[model samples]
Target: MKPEKLSDIKKELAGRTVQELTEICLRIAKYKKENKELLNYLLFDSDDPLLFSEKVKTFLEEDFKAMQKHYYHSTKSLRKILRIMNRYAKYTGNKQVEVEFSLWFCTNFLHYADLNTSHKPLQAIFIRQLEKISRLLPKLHEDLQFDYQGEFETLLHKADSQARWVSKSLYL
Candidate 1:
């Protein structure tokens, strides 16, 4: 069976009593981890998007410290970290959180993993995040964009100075 449209779902939900709605939500949360996570965020973390993002960053920092330095594991770890970050960002419906968290991720990724191993996939993942930042920057508020741009440029400079693979020109 096909899923109902969001508008139709909303209309149906609007007709329900509060108790019924709560029961429905609990039932939905029982079926999927993402639904439960979204409920948790809405109930506990939605008040402070910045705090939620910071929590995610701290979790990522720990993951980075634990990451294996080998190229294969490192790439796998990066993908996992991004998956976690993206999930949190998706809950907030905020571009700034996504952009800021990604920048922090890329910078930490550079410091946590050695770049001179001639692993193109690792380098490409790094560049892909920079490209994501470029795409997202224009969508954020002007003041935040300015601040993140400075950090972005500084990140690019650090990358350029430290590795031949990360070119500042292509991203900016």
Candidate 2:
């Protein structure tokens, strides 16, 4: 079945009392993980997006630390971690959080999963995510875009400079 449009949903919800809305939201959250995560963010984490992003980063770091070091396993594990991070980013639907999460992913990928460059598929995955982060940057407010642009530029430069080094070290 087709879902109702967001505007229609908003109009209907506008007439709801606080308790009614809470009950409806709780019922929705009962059946879907994404719904629950979104509700949790709106209720508790929305007040401090930076903290939420940092918490996600910590989770990413832990996942990275637990990853198998073999190149084949590393690529698969990185993809899984990135998928989880993207889900958290979607729960917020916040551009700043997206950029921050992407930056954190890139940093962790480069530092802990340097072997990404050793395999063409892994390198392509890294580049694709960089492209996605670039796309997201333009969607932020002008001030935030400018600030994040600087960070992306630095990341791009590092990725480019490290490519050759990563290739050379492939046999080590």
Model 1 lDDT vs. the true structure? 0.91
Per-residue error for 171 in candidate 2, Å, reads: 27
Cα RMSD of all models vs. native, in order, equals 0.9, 4.7
Residue pairs whose backbone atoms clash in candidate 1: none
Query: Compared to the true structure, candidate 1 yields what TM-score?
Result: 0.97
In model 1, where do residues sit more than 4 Å from their true spots? none
What TM-score number comes out for model 2?
0.82
Candidate of highest TM-score: 1
Best by lDDT: 1
Candidate 2 global Cα RMSD: 4.7
lDDT of 1 at 2: 100
